[model samples]
Target: MAPPAPARRPYHHGDLRRAILTAALDVVAADGPGAISLRDLARRAGVSHAAPAHHFKDRAGLLTAIAAEGYSLLADALAEVPAGTPDSLRELGVQYVRFALAHPAHFEVMHRPELLHRDDLEFVAARSLAWHRLRRGVESRAAAGRGPDLEQAVLAAWSLAHGYATLRLSGNIPGEGDPAEAFRALARLTFGEPGD
Candidate 1:
């Protein structure tokens, strides 16, 4: 016998890829991207050391996949905020902050520049789609005479949400009372305040 044909693995080891990625996400979430490693991930997933390599060539490949997944998730969150309406785009701003809070692993990978593959096709496509959706919302608000201008509105919303997420992640914004509720309260006050 030819060494029993290497014990042919199962067609699906209870979604091995997903398990590995999930393990990687947990690791990245707790300690950030630099903490991720294939050997550990495989061990956590109870798979062979080479298993993750089959799905992702290396650490960078894993991060790229995580980032792509993050963009897709952000797109879904933005979709929940409605299409039109004055400052409807801001709802997505709120959602973005919330998503980051809920999925720090994905968010970390999505924003980390040196870790992810900039040339990744899926990552680029999903990121473009998310950005276009945000831009369309901003332009619509501007056309409806609610937003100041397209660029300004986009910048305002992006900065506010991104800043808020960073603050939450970095513990720059302290206190209890739920980060999501605090985020919404601050957003309402920020955009709803008087004066142009």
Candidate 2:
């Protein structure tokens, strides 16, 4: 009879959590979130198949962490520009698109609520922070009667930016040129010149 295969060693050193997350992001970027597998991620991260469970209880847990991280990153990107100005709003949209493209893996998972633990506290807080940043730009417009209702303005801005990013990412935008430039052009068309 043949001998049994040797057992794999457990990952006990370094940041296994970060390593698994990085591997998961790579897989998501290459094949979308549905293609993610804990076994595959562990293999890619050079850990035992059970190692990912130490950090993420399951696939949903892993995705939840990714979504939270994505929102936090988006919040940081949006916060760079000063809020409560027309120019700042435009810049925020540009930043949103940039973040989407720059982190396609995280972007993909972040928007798919069904694939994540939607009630996760970290995810909720991070998402709320991103929304707060995005909403700040519209508050001034609504207060000054320069824009539509506050919620409507926020939704409109979000729709435009998210739609553009989704289209661009899916190759439906029909351009190999600069995406941010295209976004600015579209923004100009939709909202007219900044001072107009």
Candidate 3:
């Protein structure tokens, strides 16, 4: 009888979990989150087909991880902008647009709740952090005697930034030069000069 084929070795390497996540992000960037498969991620990462499952459990788990990571990144970006001023609020909107453009895969997956475990603790916490970061500017504006309704201010800012980014990402904004500049002009038009 032929000798049994050599047993397949388990994947062992530097940060297999990160590798799988990165590969999945690339697929997400190219073909949207719905196109990703754990098997495909394994192939892209040069591991056995079962290897990705060891880390992510399933597709939803992988997406929840991505969403959580994305929100944390977004919160960090927002935090980098100076706070507690009208100009800072405008800057936050610009930063929001920048993050979406820079991390299209993460941006895409972060908003699609149907594809993730929305109640996952890490995901919820990250999302809440990002929301609070976004809300900070609105609260600051209210504090500065603008007297804007807190909920409305937050929703307006979010809607503006999110809508602009979604339009640009969908190619609906033709020949948009410099997303930051475009956003700044739109913000100025909508809300007047930052300090107004």
Candidate 4:
């Protein structure tokens, strides 16, 4: 008879939550959000089948946490651009697309509210922070009379950048040049010269 496999260790209490989230992201990156399950995350993290449930009660909870984290990271990325510079909007667009490219799994989950706890407080706050950052960039341009209509400018900038990022993520935008460069070119064409 063959020997039985060794037992797996319980997840360490200090790192279990992070481990599960990381495992979930890996699974999402590999097979999309629909494939995620608490048991599978626990298995990937080498924890008890119930471990993920302790941190996230269900799949929606887990996805909500991921979306919150994604929005927070996006806010931080946009904050890196100087707030009122002429190039800020262009740079912000590039960063937005870069963030999507860097975190495709999170990006996919972040926009799909039906798969997450969209009413969750943390998720709502994080999403607002990210939206505020993008809106602030557009508002600054409007303040300078570069774009006369604040709401329209915000919509245009956001729609263009988000559309570009989504297209790139879906493998519809092809090129060997850097994605950021492509965004910059498109931004120039759509918004006119960077410092105009």
lDDT of each: 0.81, 0.89, 0.90, 0.89
Q: Write the per-residue lDDT of candidate 1 for residues 1-196, one digit (tens) a residue.
A: 4565567676667887789889999998788889999999998988789989998899999999999999999988888877776556667777888788888889888988799888989989999888877777677767766658678778887888888898888887884667666766776776663212
- Which rank order by lDDT, best down to worst? 3, 4, 2, 1
Off by over 4 Å in 4: 1-13
TM-score of each: 0.85, 0.91, 0.91, 0.91
Clash count for candidate 2 is 0
TM-score, prediction 4: 0.91
Regions more than 4 Å wrong, model 3: 1-11
Supply every candidate's count of residue pairs whose N, Cα or C atoms clash at under 3 angstroms: 0, 0, 0, 0
| Tens digit per residue, CA lDDT, model 4, 1-196 | 9899899995356788888888889989999999998998887787788878888999999999999999999999999998988888888998899999999988999989999988899999999999999988888888888885888888899889899999988889885689998999999999987568
Q: Give the runs in model 2 whose Cα sits over 4 Å from its true position.
A: 1-11
Model 3 is weakest, by summed lDDT over 10 consecutive residues, at: 187-196
lDDT, model 2? 0.89
Q: Which stretches of candidate 1 lie over 4 Å from their true place?
A: 1-12, 178-181, 188-196
Q: How far does residue 112 in candidate 3 sit from its true spot (Å)? A: 0.2
